[model samples]
Target chain A: MSAAGGSNPEYVIARVRARRSALFGDEEYRKLVRMGPAEIARFMEESEYEAEINALGSRYSGVDLIEYGLNHNMAKQFNDILDWADGRLYDLIARYLRKFDAWNVKTIIRGIYSETPRDEIETDLIRAGEFDDRLISRLLDAAEIEEVVELLSGTIFADGLEAAYDDYEDVGVLVPLENAVDRAFYEQLLDGLVVGEETKQYREFLEAEIDFRNARNALRIARSGADLDPTDYFIEGGTLFRAAELAALATNPDELVSKIRDSRYGDRLSNALSDLEEADSLIGFERALDAALLEYADTLGYVFPLSVTPIISYILAKEREVDNIRAIARGREAGLPPEEIEEELVIQ
Target chain B: MIEAIEPLMTALQSEAASGPAISPSAAAALAVGLAAFGAGYAERGIGSAAMGAIAEDEDLFVNGLILTVLPETLVILALVVVFLV
Candidate 1:
């Protein structure tokens, strides 16, 4: 827990491996998909989510209980990992976890813009980031988007958000602010990362994530046929597409798909790429991207057992578990068939 | 400094001509010390990892303890030199 001391990767990896073993497997997900929301709550109470489920049991019911329990448990588990890491490990982990801070800031800005109640917005805020509760509370109290931007002035999102605020004023849309936040998060993701042998794979993983994000943005713009400039949404640090290239590729989905097919990720994403051609929807392709990334991180963890890879793999797996469970619970609540819900899960 | 150490140097040279710089037992002792140091360094990682496992699940205490001390075999093997010398 001491950030000043040398990193304790041995300790963290040990604990993380133990926890990783406890994560839901294919059998568990297969069983969970069949269960109703109430049954799922009961099922979860007997597992790693027991504490969160029980704590929120009386306050919420059905899918809401499951959703809240998943969020709370995810936040607690990630926070525990952060607390356990020290020195370089903490910095590395915090770099990724700061995405939650970005998520919270965007949530708050959107809530302020939409005039949503503070309490509702508070529940949506995931406290798994480096931002402390005080700053988060202060953010929640900010009545205007300008105040939210001001509160984050000392953060990485400050400069991008400030510039985007002017765009927001001109367009009267949240896209500029949200994109700015996303760009800030991605920009800082690889900022000053020390690329040792162990971290080289990690760097590649981060780059792939950025690449996927950019690809997803380009594909979306292309599919929607919106006259929006893809360069505006282009995140740096991705090797796959330059901003100018993305601008060009966004006009033609076929050429964009071919470009991705020829890249290094082509082999891994070949199936998803074909599925994209057949389905004419990006949802399956997007889910495949997530699954590919998760599987890649999972394998990389074993390549260097003592490095930050295992911890990151655990983070990704835990997030996937949360997301999968949420999808199942929400799907069941909506009376969606088991087969469709199964398709929605991003399991490897 | 050279002039001051000339007599000491002659004495060390004479000693060196008759015998090894260190006695066999002393050399054995040095090996054991180095071996023990290596074991301790190895155990530092194992011990922390074991403690982490034990913290997560109390039933792992016995397993953790065994793994933590597995490296001590190096020291024990090194001790055989003490008797051999």
Candidate 2:
């Protein structure tokens, strides 16, 4: 692909930077937390989501409209990035966007398991992944889990899901199947990732993400005091903890704290570890991870302005936007006050 | 693409090997023209990127225009070449 055409990283980065600056910052989320769902949707309609809002207005209303608009805007913005990128940029961006594909696949499988209608499952899908319409349509048409696995034959999720299907049959739970998909995606993300000066930095950024995710999962399992194995949920390629280490640490919260305190991420996550000790809150730890990821992305962007880091940073920020907006909308609907709702958002 | 430059390189070299490539005025003109070519090449990239930015947000028009011509200083420097030639 790189041989067929040269990429314009500088040009694309310039445009991406412009778009990045337009993403909502802390103050915006704070204000958004103060508004009701209708007000939030109105605010979105007057912002970058205007077109999506207007288009989905007739089909949905209130929080549903906001939800649809958010999804629509996410798809559109990501599609625009794909449209602008060329050659290797396209490849790099596609690598990350496939996360959504993993998300959609999980959603579909869970929905099918719960016996949801195909159309309803389809509505939850974000079509920003590399999966073409035909593939998705075939997936939607699948009548059974076996059929779904068969339909996914050519995709990255195929083999993993096939194996997981066996475990699913034996256990009669979807954990194995869903985990297979997540592992497949994460494994593929770092496969064959040769790095240059710039992409090296991008690789590091990605590792930070992997590390944080593993940490979050470990913390969740640790907090729940569940009997399940932590290694069962371990994702590869993170620089922090190994599967065995995480499995061991999952059983002891204090030891996990000391382990995290001594790791390379210790400095960045110190406050979170303290909060974990004091408030006994996983939310604080999760927010700290988010903040750390955002800070890492920011640093990476400056270090490699013309590479994939900025694009990845933008993707992270955009995802955060969708999450924050959703949090605000849901919080309002649940009758939570603005300040309490704001606590649920991660705006940095 | 590279072959195009080979003949031009030869022509320039042959002219210089002569008693003089041209009169001082003509030599200066050549210098200015070369500078202008370089500037234009630089502008091609900047201008396209600037236009892209402007298309996304209209407020960038002035900043884009300024950046597009930043390389024009090369041509202005070549103006001195005109006098020296």
Q: TM-score for every candidate vs. truth?
A: 0.95, 0.87
Interface DockQ per candidate: 0.73, 0.27
Off by over 4 Å in 2: A1-7, B1-41
RMSD for all candidates, in order, please: 2.4, 6.1
What TM-score would candidate 2 get against the native? 0.87
CAPRI verdict (incorrect, acceptable, medium, high) for model 1: medium
Per-residue CA lDDT of model 2 for A1-348, tens digit only, reads: 132244366567678778888888877887888888889989998888999899989988889899989998998888788888887788888888998889888888888899999989987989878887788888888878888888888889999999999999999899998899888888877787868877887887778778888888888898887788889899999888999989988888899889889988899889889999999988778888888887876676777666778788888888888988988898899999988987777777
lDDT for each residue of candidate 1 in B45-79, tens digit (9 for 90 to 100): 88999989999999999999999999999999999
**DockQ score for candidate 1:** 0.73
lDDT of each: 0.92, 0.84
